[model samples]
Target: MNYEIIINSIASIGVILSVIFLAYQIKKNTQASRANYYDSLNKTNMEFLRQLVENRELGELLEKATSNWDNLNEDDKRTSNYLFIQLFRHWENMFYQHKLSVLDKQLWTNHLNTMIGYFHHDGTQEWWLKRKMAFAKDFRDFLEKTEKPKQIYPTIKDLTIKNK
Candidate 1:
């Protein structure tokens, strides 16, 4: 009887330890996954910036499109349309990531502010109105409901100008 009781107690302890170990592993895996996601997101952002920096014509087109879409010729308008599509697609991905808790709240807030800043421009708003259906319904609804920031943000052209 004594031996049987000791065996049962040990088995229960073993089960508890296994449960603790499993929980720790799950937490670690989640952290690793989140890190990987952040890294990938950063890489994508860098690639976009790199493209703009490396291609002068592309950079100028983006500046013009954001500042005055109506001024662009037909071919430039088509190109700018595709550029906005890519930009919005990244924003949509960020939205879903934040919704899923994969992205940090502070980071999402910063990105949201940047998005709102873009919307402050007439050209950006125009592009969104025409292509909003290409994104997720929830994302579209969220953007539509968000109030534009009271302070106007600078455009790409403003940022590119030399201070001197």
Candidate 2:
């Protein structure tokens, strides 16, 4: 009887230790997953920014398209369309990530503010009206419901004028 009780206690302690170890591993994995996801998102954003930095013509086109889409020539308009598509697709991905709790709330809020700032431009709004359907319905609905700022965010042109 004494031997049986000693074995049962040992088994119980081993089971508890295994459960604790499993919980720790699960937590470690979750942290790693979140870190990996954030890193990927940052890399994607950097790639976009790098393109704008490395290609002066593309940067200029983006500025013009965001500020004056109607004034662009047919070819410029097509290029601008593709640019906006890529930009909005990235935003849509961020939106879904936030919805899935993969993205941090504060980070999502910052991104949302930037998105709203972009939308404050009439040209961006016009582009969205035409191309919004290309995105997922949920993302479209989220953007449609977002409140744009009353004042437009400063563009490169606006900054140039301010400097002068």
| lDDT of each candidate versus the true structure | 0.86, 0.88
Output candidate 1 Cα RMSD.
1.7
lDDT of candidate model 2 versus the reference: 0.88
- Model 2 stretches astray by more than 4 angstroms: none
Task: Give me candidate 1's TM-score against the actual structure.
Answer: 0.92
lDDT string, candidate 1, 18-91, tens digits: 99999999999999999999998889889888998999898888878887787789999999998888888899
Model 2 RMSD in Å is 1.5
TM-score, per-candidate, Cα-based = 0.92, 0.92
Residue lDDT tens for model 2, 1-164: 99999999999999999999999999999889989989988998898889989999998898888887888899999999998998898899998889889899998888888888887687888787888889999988888887778776778888999999
Off by over 4 Å in 1: 159-164
| Winning candidate number (lDDT) | 2
Model 2: weakest 10-residue lDDT segment is 146-155
**Model 1 poorest ten-residue lDDT run:** 155-164
